[model samples]
Target: MPPVEEETVVFRSRFNRILAAVFWVVCAAALVAIGLTYAYRPTGSVAGLAVGSVLIGVAVLVVLWRPQLTVSDDAIVVRNVLSTIVVPWNALIHVDTKYALTLITPQRKVAVWCAPAPGATAALRASRAQGTQARAWTAASDLRPGDLAGTESGRAAFLVRSRWNTLREQGRIELGTAGDQRVQVQPHVASIAGLVAGVVAVALVTILL
Candidate 1:
Protein backbone atom coordinates (compact mmCIF):
# COMPACT_ATOMS: atom_id res chain seq x y z
CA MET A 1 0.00 0.00 0.00
CA PRO A 2 1.14 3.54 -0.70
CA PRO A 3 1.69 5.97 2.16
CA VAL A 4 -0.93 8.67 2.51
CA GLU A 5 -0.79 12.11 4.10
CA GLU A 6 -3.47 12.76 6.70
CA GLU A 7 -3.73 16.14 8.40
CA THR A 8 -0.25 17.07 7.28
CA VAL A 9 1.04 19.98 5.29
CA VAL A 10 3.15 18.50 2.49
CA PHE A 11 5.19 20.79 0.29
CA ARG A 12 6.75 19.82 -3.02
CA SER A 13 8.02 21.93 -5.91
CA ARG A 14 5.51 21.98 -8.76
CA PHE A 15 8.37 22.89 -11.10
CA ASN A 16 10.23 19.70 -10.29
CA ARG A 17 7.18 17.53 -11.00
CA ILE A 18 6.48 19.35 -14.27
CA LEU A 19 10.11 19.04 -15.36
CA ALA A 20 10.18 15.32 -14.57
CA ALA A 21 6.96 14.87 -16.53
CA VAL A 22 8.44 16.59 -19.56
CA PHE A 23 11.61 14.49 -19.33
CA TRP A 24 9.57 11.28 -19.03
CA VAL A 25 7.62 12.21 -22.15
CA VAL A 26 10.87 12.74 -24.01
CA CYS A 27 12.20 9.42 -22.75
CA ALA A 28 9.04 7.69 -23.97
CA ALA A 29 9.41 9.25 -27.40
CA ALA A 30 13.04 8.19 -27.51
CA LEU A 31 12.06 4.64 -26.58
CA VAL A 32 9.57 4.57 -29.43
CA ALA A 33 12.23 5.82 -31.81
CA ILE A 34 14.63 3.15 -30.55
CA GLY A 35 11.99 0.44 -31.18
CA LEU A 36 11.43 1.68 -34.70
CA THR A 37 15.19 1.75 -35.42
CA TYR A 38 15.56 -1.77 -34.03
CA ALA A 39 12.78 -3.01 -36.33
CA TYR A 40 14.39 -1.40 -39.37
CA ARG A 41 17.86 -2.88 -38.67
CA PRO A 42 18.42 -4.57 -35.33
CA THR A 43 21.91 -4.31 -33.85
CA GLY A 44 23.58 -5.03 -30.50
CA SER A 45 25.02 -1.49 -30.40
CA VAL A 46 21.58 0.07 -30.82
CA ALA A 47 20.21 -2.09 -27.97
CA GLY A 48 23.07 -1.15 -25.67
CA LEU A 49 22.68 2.56 -26.38
CA ALA A 50 18.95 2.42 -25.81
CA VAL A 51 19.43 0.57 -22.51
CA GLY A 52 22.06 3.05 -21.33
CA SER A 53 19.94 6.06 -22.23
CA VAL A 54 16.92 4.65 -20.45
CA LEU A 55 18.91 4.00 -17.27
CA ILE A 56 20.37 7.49 -17.30
CA GLY A 57 16.96 9.04 -17.87
CA VAL A 58 15.44 7.07 -14.99
CA ALA A 59 18.22 8.15 -12.64
CA VAL A 60 17.68 11.80 -13.50
CA LEU A 61 13.94 11.50 -13.01
CA VAL A 62 14.41 10.02 -9.54
CA VAL A 63 16.62 12.93 -8.55
CA LEU A 64 13.97 15.41 -9.64
CA TRP A 65 11.14 13.70 -7.75
CA ARG A 66 12.93 12.76 -4.53
CA PRO A 67 12.99 15.89 -2.35
CA GLN A 68 10.01 17.13 -0.34
CA LEU A 69 9.16 18.62 3.09
CA THR A 70 6.25 17.60 5.26
CA VAL A 71 4.98 19.31 8.37
CA SER A 72 2.87 17.64 11.03
CA ASP A 73 1.96 18.78 14.53
CA ASP A 74 4.83 16.95 16.20
CA ALA A 75 7.61 17.06 13.61
CA ILE A 76 8.96 18.37 10.33
CA VAL A 77 9.90 15.56 7.97
CA VAL A 78 12.51 16.54 5.41
CA ARG A 79 12.87 14.09 2.57
CA ASN A 80 16.09 14.84 0.72
CA VAL A 81 17.54 12.76 -2.15
CA LEU A 82 19.65 10.43 0.01
CA SER A 83 17.96 10.51 3.41
CA THR A 84 15.00 11.66 5.47
CA ILE A 85 15.38 13.66 8.69
CA VAL A 86 12.65 13.97 11.26
CA VAL A 87 12.97 16.93 13.62
CA PRO A 88 10.51 17.16 16.43
CA TRP A 89 9.23 20.62 17.31
CA ASN A 90 10.51 20.37 20.86
CA ALA A 91 14.01 19.60 19.62
CA LEU A 92 14.19 22.48 17.14
CA ILE A 93 16.34 25.43 18.22
CA HIS A 94 16.27 27.77 15.25
CA VAL A 95 15.32 27.86 11.55
CA ASP A 96 17.84 29.31 9.13
CA THR A 97 17.78 29.95 5.37
CA LYS A 98 21.33 31.12 4.73
CA TYR A 99 21.95 28.46 2.07
CA ALA A 100 18.76 26.49 2.11
CA LEU A 101 15.78 26.48 4.50
CA THR A 102 17.46 24.66 7.36
CA LEU A 103 16.41 23.31 10.74
CA ILE A 104 18.95 24.08 13.42
CA THR A 105 18.86 21.42 16.10
CA PRO A 106 21.24 21.08 19.01
CA GLN A 107 23.12 18.14 17.46
CA ARG A 108 23.18 18.99 13.77
CA LYS A 109 21.86 21.36 11.13
CA VAL A 110 19.64 19.85 8.43
CA ALA A 111 19.18 21.66 5.12
CA VAL A 112 16.05 21.27 3.07
CA TRP A 113 17.23 20.41 -0.46
CA CYS A 114 13.90 21.14 -2.13
CA ALA A 115 13.90 24.61 -0.62
CA PRO A 116 17.24 25.94 -1.84
CA ALA A 117 18.03 29.63 -1.41
CA PRO A 118 17.92 31.98 -4.35
CA GLY A 119 21.24 32.96 -5.99
CA ALA A 120 22.64 36.46 -6.63
CA THR A 121 20.41 37.24 -9.59
CA ALA A 122 17.37 36.27 -7.58
CA ALA A 123 18.58 38.06 -4.44
CA LEU A 124 19.02 41.27 -6.43
CA ARG A 125 15.43 41.02 -7.64
CA ALA A 126 14.15 40.19 -4.13
CA SER A 127 14.76 43.51 -2.36
CA ARG A 128 11.47 44.90 -3.61
CA ALA A 129 9.65 41.72 -2.56
CA GLN A 130 10.74 41.22 1.04
CA GLY A 131 8.13 40.30 3.65
CA THR A 132 7.80 39.56 7.42
CA GLN A 133 9.38 36.10 7.60
CA ALA A 134 12.39 37.56 9.33
CA ARG A 135 10.40 39.54 11.89
CA ALA A 136 10.68 36.87 14.58
CA TRP A 137 14.02 35.43 13.49
CA THR A 138 17.52 36.53 14.50
CA ALA A 139 18.22 38.86 11.58
CA ALA A 140 14.83 40.50 11.82
CA SER A 141 16.05 43.78 10.35
CA ASP A 142 18.26 42.44 7.57
CA LEU A 143 16.71 40.05 5.06
CA ARG A 144 18.44 37.56 2.79
CA PRO A 145 17.00 36.51 -0.56
CA GLY A 146 15.84 33.24 0.95
CA ASP A 147 14.01 35.17 3.68
CA LEU A 148 11.78 36.87 1.12
CA ALA A 149 8.20 35.59 1.02
CA GLY A 150 8.44 34.95 -2.74
CA THR A 151 11.30 32.45 -2.48
CA GLU A 152 11.16 28.66 -2.12
CA SER A 153 13.28 28.71 1.03
CA GLY A 154 11.17 31.43 2.62
CA ARG A 155 7.91 29.60 1.98
CA ALA A 156 9.20 26.40 3.58
CA ALA A 157 10.81 28.26 6.42
CA PHE A 158 7.52 30.04 7.08
CA LEU A 159 5.62 26.82 7.57
CA VAL A 160 8.21 25.60 10.04
CA ARG A 161 8.64 28.92 11.80
CA SER A 162 4.92 29.56 12.10
CA ARG A 163 4.28 26.28 13.86
CA TRP A 164 7.36 26.59 16.00
CA ASN A 165 6.34 30.08 17.07
CA THR A 166 2.85 28.92 17.92
CA LEU A 167 4.27 26.14 20.03
CA ARG A 168 6.57 28.50 21.85
CA GLU A 169 3.82 31.01 22.51
CA GLN A 170 1.55 28.25 23.79
CA GLY A 171 4.31 27.16 26.15
CA ARG A 172 4.51 23.70 24.59
CA ILE A 173 8.14 24.02 23.57
CA GLU A 174 10.57 24.77 26.37
CA LEU A 175 13.92 26.46 26.01
CA GLY A 176 17.18 24.56 26.46
CA THR A 177 15.30 21.25 26.31
CA ALA A 178 16.42 20.36 22.78
CA GLY A 179 18.83 17.72 24.00
CA ASP A 180 16.03 15.78 25.67
CA GLN A 181 14.15 15.13 22.43
CA ARG A 182 15.54 12.73 19.81
CA VAL A 183 16.04 13.59 16.16
CA GLN A 184 15.98 10.67 13.75
CA VAL A 185 17.94 10.47 10.49
CA GLN A 186 17.08 7.65 8.16
CA PRO A 187 19.29 6.98 5.13
CA HIS A 188 17.62 5.97 1.90
CA VAL A 189 19.89 2.98 1.33
CA ALA A 190 17.58 1.24 -1.15
CA SER A 191 17.12 4.36 -3.23
CA ILE A 192 20.86 4.99 -3.21
CA ALA A 193 21.63 1.40 -4.19
CA GLY A 194 19.09 1.50 -7.01
CA LEU A 195 20.54 4.71 -8.41
CA VAL A 196 24.07 3.35 -8.14
CA ALA A 197 23.06 0.15 -9.97
CA GLY A 198 21.34 2.15 -12.70
CA VAL A 199 24.43 4.32 -13.20
CA VAL A 200 26.68 1.27 -13.30
CA ALA A 201 24.46 -0.40 -15.91
CA VAL A 202 24.48 2.68 -18.08
CA ALA A 203 28.24 3.13 -17.73
CA LEU A 204 28.98 -0.53 -18.54
CA VAL A 205 26.86 -0.40 -21.70
CA THR A 206 28.41 2.89 -22.86
CA ILE A 207 31.94 1.72 -22.04
CA LEU A 208 31.56 -1.61 -23.84
CA LEU A 209 30.65 0.25 -27.02
Candidate 2:
Protein backbone atom coordinates (compact mmCIF):
# COMPACT_ATOMS: atom_id res chain seq x y z
CA MET A 1 0.00 0.00 0.00
CA PRO A 2 1.23 3.51 -0.88
CA PRO A 3 2.02 5.50 2.25
CA VAL A 4 -0.48 8.23 3.08
CA GLU A 5 1.28 11.59 2.95
CA GLU A 6 0.26 14.79 4.69
CA GLU A 7 1.19 18.40 4.01
CA THR A 8 3.99 19.68 6.25
CA VAL A 9 5.13 23.20 7.07
CA VAL A 10 8.91 23.52 6.81
CA PHE A 11 9.68 26.26 9.29
CA ARG A 12 13.07 27.99 9.10
CA SER A 13 14.49 30.33 11.68
CA ARG A 14 15.72 33.84 10.75
CA PHE A 15 18.97 33.43 12.72
CA ASN A 16 20.70 31.76 9.74
CA ARG A 17 21.16 35.14 8.05
CA ILE A 18 23.14 36.41 11.01
CA LEU A 19 25.26 33.29 11.05
CA ALA A 20 26.07 33.56 7.33
CA ALA A 21 27.06 37.18 7.70
CA VAL A 22 29.45 36.32 10.51
CA PHE A 23 31.04 33.53 8.51
CA TRP A 24 31.53 35.80 5.51
CA VAL A 25 33.29 38.41 7.60
CA VAL A 26 35.59 35.79 9.06
CA CYS A 27 36.49 34.48 5.61
CA ALA A 28 37.39 37.93 4.35
CA ALA A 29 39.58 38.64 7.36
CA ALA A 30 41.42 35.36 6.99
CA LEU A 31 42.13 36.08 3.35
CA VAL A 32 43.39 39.58 4.05
CA ALA A 33 45.58 38.31 6.90
CA ILE A 34 47.34 35.90 4.55
CA GLY A 35 48.01 38.63 1.98
CA LEU A 36 49.36 41.00 4.63
CA THR A 37 51.62 38.36 6.16
CA TYR A 38 53.14 37.57 2.75
CA ALA A 39 53.85 41.24 1.91
CA TYR A 40 55.26 42.46 5.29
CA ARG A 41 57.45 39.69 6.69
CA PRO A 42 61.17 40.59 7.26
CA THR A 43 62.54 37.17 6.31
CA GLY A 44 61.08 36.40 2.89
CA SER A 45 60.60 32.68 3.47
CA VAL A 46 59.07 31.41 0.24
CA ALA A 47 57.43 28.55 2.05
CA GLY A 48 55.66 30.77 4.60
CA LEU A 49 54.46 33.17 1.88
CA ALA A 50 53.07 30.28 -0.17
CA VAL A 51 51.17 28.76 2.74
CA GLY A 52 49.74 32.08 3.98
CA SER A 53 48.51 33.19 0.57
CA VAL A 54 46.71 29.89 0.02
CA LEU A 55 45.01 30.06 3.40
CA ILE A 56 43.75 33.62 2.83
CA GLY A 57 42.48 33.04 -0.71
CA VAL A 58 40.60 29.95 0.36
CA ALA A 59 38.95 31.85 3.21
CA VAL A 60 37.69 34.54 0.82
CA LEU A 61 36.04 32.03 -1.49
CA VAL A 62 34.32 30.21 1.36
CA VAL A 63 32.68 33.42 2.58
CA LEU A 64 31.66 34.46 -0.93
CA TRP A 65 30.12 31.06 -1.52
CA ARG A 66 26.99 30.79 0.57
CA PRO A 67 24.40 27.99 0.78
CA GLN A 68 20.65 28.47 0.90
CA LEU A 69 17.58 26.48 1.93
CA THR A 70 14.20 26.36 0.24
CA VAL A 71 10.82 24.99 1.22
CA SER A 72 7.99 23.81 -1.03
CA ASP A 73 4.70 21.99 -0.89
CA ASP A 74 6.33 18.60 -1.42
CA ALA A 75 9.83 18.89 0.00
CA ILE A 76 12.54 20.86 1.76
CA VAL A 77 15.56 21.52 -0.43
CA VAL A 78 19.02 22.43 0.83
CA ARG A 79 21.37 23.96 -1.71
CA ASN A 80 25.12 24.08 -1.10
CA VAL A 81 28.18 24.59 -3.29
CA LEU A 82 28.72 20.88 -3.99
CA SER A 83 25.24 19.31 -3.93
CA THR A 84 21.50 19.71 -3.44
CA ILE A 85 19.06 17.57 -1.48
CA VAL A 86 15.30 17.20 -1.85
CA VAL A 87 13.70 15.56 1.17
CA PRO A 88 10.00 14.97 0.69
CA TRP A 89 7.57 15.72 3.49
CA ASN A 90 6.43 12.11 3.60
CA ALA A 91 10.01 10.92 3.84
CA LEU A 92 10.68 13.24 6.77
CA ILE A 93 9.34 11.03 9.51
CA HIS A 94 10.45 13.50 12.19
CA VAL A 95 12.03 16.91 12.89
CA ASP A 96 13.81 17.80 16.09
CA THR A 97 16.31 20.42 17.24
CA LYS A 98 19.99 19.58 16.77
CA TYR A 99 21.27 17.19 19.43
CA ALA A 100 20.38 13.87 20.95
CA LEU A 101 17.49 13.20 18.57
CA THR A 102 17.06 11.56 15.19
CA LEU A 103 14.14 12.10 12.84
CA ILE A 104 12.98 8.68 11.77
CA THR A 105 10.91 7.55 8.83
CA PRO A 106 10.14 3.99 7.80
CA GLN A 107 12.88 4.18 5.17
CA ARG A 108 15.45 6.56 6.69
CA LYS A 109 16.58 8.79 9.56
CA VAL A 110 18.59 12.02 9.98
CA ALA A 111 21.13 12.55 12.73
CA VAL A 112 20.86 15.72 14.82
CA TRP A 113 23.50 17.04 17.22
CA CYS A 114 24.27 19.93 19.66
CA ALA A 115 20.80 20.27 21.14
CA PRO A 116 20.22 22.33 24.29
CA ALA A 117 21.19 20.60 27.52
CA PRO A 118 18.91 20.29 30.56
CA GLY A 119 20.56 23.29 32.21
CA ALA A 120 19.69 25.53 29.27
CA THR A 121 16.08 24.44 29.47
CA ALA A 122 15.83 25.27 33.15
CA ALA A 123 17.46 28.70 32.65
CA LEU A 124 15.08 29.57 29.81
CA ARG A 125 12.07 28.64 31.93
CA ALA A 126 13.29 30.77 34.81
CA SER A 127 14.00 33.75 32.54
CA ARG A 128 10.56 33.55 30.94
CA ALA A 129 8.82 33.47 34.31
CA GLN A 130 10.86 36.45 35.50
CA GLY A 131 10.06 38.42 32.37
CA THR A 132 6.36 37.70 32.74
CA GLN A 133 6.34 38.95 36.31
CA ALA A 134 8.21 42.13 35.38
CA ARG A 135 5.81 42.86 32.55
CA ALA A 136 2.73 42.43 34.76
CA TRP A 137 3.68 45.62 36.61
CA THR A 138 2.46 47.67 33.63
CA ALA A 139 -1.03 48.15 32.24
CA ALA A 140 0.05 46.62 28.93
CA SER A 141 0.63 43.23 30.39
CA ASP A 142 1.70 40.38 28.14
CA LEU A 143 -1.15 38.78 26.23
CA ARG A 144 -2.65 35.92 28.14
CA PRO A 145 -2.74 32.43 26.62
CA GLY A 146 -6.40 32.78 25.68
CA ASP A 147 -5.59 35.89 23.64
CA LEU A 148 -2.51 34.51 21.84
CA ALA A 149 -3.25 30.81 21.49
CA GLY A 150 -6.00 31.64 19.02
CA THR A 151 -3.65 33.70 16.89
CA GLU A 152 -2.09 32.30 13.74
CA SER A 153 1.46 31.63 14.98
CA GLY A 154 0.30 30.04 18.20
CA ARG A 155 -2.25 27.92 16.38
CA ALA A 156 0.34 26.77 13.89
CA ALA A 157 2.67 25.59 16.65
CA PHE A 158 -0.21 23.80 18.33
CA LEU A 159 -1.18 22.05 15.11
CA VAL A 160 2.40 21.02 14.37
CA ARG A 161 2.89 19.65 17.86
CA SER A 162 -0.38 17.75 17.63
CA ARG A 163 0.58 16.23 14.28
CA TRP A 164 4.05 15.30 15.57
CA ASN A 165 2.41 13.54 18.50
CA THR A 166 0.23 11.66 16.06
CA LEU A 167 3.30 10.53 14.13
CA ARG A 168 4.92 9.35 17.36
CA GLU A 169 1.83 7.32 18.19
CA GLN A 170 1.93 5.77 14.71
CA GLY A 171 5.52 4.53 15.26
CA ARG A 172 6.88 6.64 12.45
CA ILE A 173 9.35 8.61 14.60
CA GLU A 174 11.67 7.65 17.46
CA LEU A 175 13.79 9.56 20.00
CA GLY A 176 17.01 7.52 20.08
CA THR A 177 19.47 5.75 17.79
CA ALA A 178 21.09 7.22 14.68
CA GLY A 179 19.29 5.38 11.88
CA ASP A 180 21.15 3.14 9.45
CA GLN A 181 20.23 5.11 6.33
CA ARG A 182 23.02 7.68 6.34
CA VAL A 183 22.18 10.69 4.18
CA GLN A 184 24.96 13.20 3.51
CA VAL A 185 23.31 16.49 4.43
CA GLN A 186 25.75 18.80 2.63
CA PRO A 187 28.10 16.91 0.36
CA HIS A 188 28.37 19.55 -2.39
CA VAL A 189 29.06 22.37 0.03
CA ALA A 190 31.94 20.51 1.63
CA SER A 191 33.46 19.56 -1.72
CA ILE A 192 33.21 23.04 -3.16
CA ALA A 193 34.66 24.67 -0.08
CA GLY A 194 37.58 22.31 -0.05
CA LEU A 195 38.34 22.76 -3.75
CA VAL A 196 38.02 26.54 -3.67
CA ALA A 197 40.17 26.82 -0.57
CA GLY A 198 42.84 24.65 -2.11
CA VAL A 199 42.96 26.64 -5.35
CA VAL A 200 43.04 29.97 -3.53
CA ALA A 201 45.90 28.78 -1.35
CA VAL A 202 47.88 27.73 -4.43
CA ALA A 203 47.26 31.07 -6.11
CA LEU A 204 48.38 33.00 -3.01
CA VAL A 205 51.56 30.92 -2.80
CA THR A 206 52.43 31.60 -6.46
CA ILE A 207 51.86 35.35 -6.11
CA LEU A 208 54.06 35.64 -2.99
CA LEU A 209 56.92 33.56 -4.35
The model with the greatest TM-score is: 1
The local distance difference test score of each candidate is: 0.79, 0.45
Model 2 C-alpha lDDT per residue in residues 1-209, reported as the tens digit of each score: 53366565443323334555566576567657756675676343544554554554454344333444344443455444455555544556555422322344556543321111124444344335557653343226543221122222233234444665665566665454333333435466565767767766666555665
How many clashing pairs per prediction, in order? 0, 7
Candidate 1 local distance difference test against the native: 0.79
- Model 1, span 24-142: residue lDDT tens: 78888888898899889777667776886687677655677778999987799999988999999889988888999999988899999888887877664654455444334425556
N/CA/C clash count, model 2 = 7
Q: Model 2's lDDT to the true fold?
A: 0.45
Candidate 2: minimum summed lDDT over ten consecutive residues — where?
Answer: 110-119
Q: Model 1 — which ten-residue stretch has the worst lDDT?
A: 129-138
